[model samples]
Target: MEQLLASDALSDSGKIMLGGAVVGLIFGYCAQQSRFCLRSACIEFWGGQLGPKLAVWLAVFGTALLATQALLANGGLNPQDVRQLATVGSLSGAIVGGLLFGVGMILARGCASRLLVLSATGNARALIAGLVVTVAAQASLSGVLSPLREALNRLWVVGPSTRDMAQHLPDGTGLALGVGCVALAGALAWRNRVAVRTTATAAGVGLAVGLGWAFTAALSRVSFEPVTVGSVTFTGPSADTLMALIVRPDVVPSFGIGLVPGVFAGSLAATLVHREFRLQGFDAGTGTVRYLVGAVLMGFGGMAAGGCAVGAGVTGGSVLSLTAWVALLSMWIGAGAAGLLLERAEAIGRRETAQL
Candidate 1:
């Protein structure tokens, strides 16, 4: 990284953006191939059918935890300066925003990352929903919804000292947690009979996340200009990428700016190679209103929570952030609740149709 920065080929920001694009590409390809999605995992867990979807999610999560912890343990990465640990956080925002994001993913049938992958495969529904999510996220960030987000964020706050879970735990606790998660993931994958290739691919998603952190951290250490150290995230990045294209075409390139298009291009390549490219649109089973509302919820909720599924749930969780863990648990609770409600509603509708 230092050598690349020393070269006059590209600017410092450009190098960071290129690094992000590489990580995003790997993430996109692996996620698409493995069908890795938190929404599907949530549904599988809540529905009492811990099938392939849950297995895949665990593979990604456990691997991510293991790899990230390994990097930190080896002194290859220092996340003290990362936003999740360095800044004040909101417990109320994590709880409320997590719940909203969980429910929104259910209604939308995908999270931010999933929507982007599907859009690349020519899913018009996902394309539309993704756009709405971007708009909503932008609004939450600096537009109409900012005031509400700020209010909720102020309801409960925690300082940086208390934010990092490692501070309160034993020295080896992070490694222990990572190992335990990996073991559980392995057991689940074995029990579910997930294919070897699929499980490996899912693990690649986690590895890509670790690589994202490593790349940024390494660059930050050597670069003259300040650079944020973060991994794979979609909510804020999606909004930033969209705004850069529309409102400020000349906006300075950043990691987030490159990540969005990189994911799309990677997913597109995967679909093309796998012969999964197909144009799709909304149908009666997939109501348009539900998706629009869900996108709005996800946008506001993700911002309030300080991250989305992959953002707070995986990346921040890997670093053992208190609020990130809280948000993840809240997301699970919300997803489970929303799943049951939807099932009951569908059952009632079926009964009514039968009676008629």
Candidate 2:
């Protein structure tokens, strides 16, 4: 385990990634079973119903911040080089990206991670989203959208690794900060869960996500290759995983299940345990055009802004990356807009049906 985090060996990185994949598997299974999703909670939870699934996400964000900070402070990893810090802030990317993502998720009926896990359970909608995202992501990553995304990246003020505070902060402070934030997020989540009376379930959900991330971080540190303690996020990694599947299938598996495969694996594992996996994506009732349009936004926005809500919201948020904060906050605005619109549409339809 100690050898896993060593900078001297590439094998360590692979070990860390493998460990991460295991943690991800657990996360996927647990998440699938629990149906944990911030957006789902936010979008689906009604008054006097389930509480916002914010805790699971908050736990992930909080833990990612604290643990990664501790690792960097202790000289276990280089925060500067981590992709989280490498991003150049892009307001347009974050906002436009988020709005597009928010809309797409609504139409697709889930976010990227949700799509992955759900697809495994036989939800064809998710499978469609996954396929569309992969193609759009490729375009955004290295195709027609590449130049546009680069232009946006260059537009931002490249901070001197404000993304690397864990490296600068004392190990103790960073550790306490990391642990404390998780604690804070936990408290808030607990209060919400209790309020909603889903205490037991929420705790389990939050625990699975937090522990999964922590486990991965520990594994990444001990593994040989370049490792950074991290957890779930669906934007870049999902895209990379998708592209890699086609381009470099043999490239060493790093930290987590690459996006394309992980979605199926995690969802399948969930389905088998629960016996709920079924193929779901062909509804003529819901416009495919609407879904595809939304997906395009997610891919382009994810690339331009550096991540989607899951990537920025949960994963990057875990690191407390300022940019992640920007992205998440922006996403809420977009999500709220879309959610509100959907609510209005539903209300109008109900009224019309009543009159008829």
Candidate 3:
């Protein structure tokens, strides 16, 4: 990496963007192949059917945790330099925003990353929903909705000292936590009889997360200009990518800017190779308004929370960010609640139809 950066072939920012693209490609391919999705995982958990969906999610999460912690333990990466730990965070935002994001993902039938993958596979509905999410996210970031997001963020704040979970834990406890999660995930996967190929792909997703961290951290260390050290995340990247396309055509290349296209390309390649590419649109069973509303909520909620499911949940959680963990738990709770409400509503509709 040092050797490559020393060469004048590309600018530092360009190289960072390329690294991001590589990580995003791996993430996209693995996520697509494994069908890794938090929304599915949440539903499976809440529905009391810990099947392949939940197993896949666990595999991704556990592996990500283990790999990231291993990197930190070995001094391959510095936790203090990372944004999730280095800066102040909002507990209130994590709770409220996570809940909103969870409910939104449920309504949209997918989270930000899932929607992007689906869009690449020619899912028109997902494509539209993703656009809406980007628009809403942009609005929350700097437009009208920014005020509301700011207000919520101010409700409860924590400093860098408290934000980093590693600071409070006993020495090596982070590594132990990672190991325990991996063991649990392995056991669950075995119990569920998840396929070996599926498990491998899921692990690949986790690998991508680790690689993302390593790439950025390494780049930041060597770069003359300041570079943010981050891993795989979709919400902020999606919004940034969209804005670059429409608002700032000449925007300088960044990691997030490259990540969006990389994921799309990887997903497209996977779907094409597997013969899974199919054009899909909205049907009567899938209402448009629900998806639109969900996209809006996800946009605002993700911004408010500082990241999306894969963003804060897997990436941030892997690094042991307090707010990220809180956000992840809140997401689960919100998703479970939303799922139950949806089920009841469907049941009521069925009964009413029968009576009529």
TM-score, model 3 to reference? 0.98
lDDT of 1 by residue, 135-178 (tens): 99999999999999999999999999999888899887888887
RMSD after Cα superposition, model 2: 4.6
Every model's TM-score:
0.97, 0.77, 0.98
lDDT (10s digit) by residue, model 3, range 1-356: 45555668988988988887888888888899999999999999999987788888888888888889988989878978989999999999999999999999999999999999999999999999999999999999999999999999999999999999999999888778777767777788899888888899999998899888888888888888899999999999999999888988597788888888999999999999999999999999899999999999899989988899999999999999999999999899989999999999999999999999
Off by over 4 Å in 1: 1-7
- Residue pairs with backbone overlap in model 3: none
Note the residue pairs that clash in candidate 1.
none
Off by over 4 Å in 2: 1-17, 44-52, 72-75, 161-231, 247-253, 256-260, 350-356
- Span of 10 residues, lowest total lDDT, candidate 1: 1-10
Off by over 4 Å in 3: 1-7
Which of 1 and 2 is the better model by lDDT?
Answer: 1
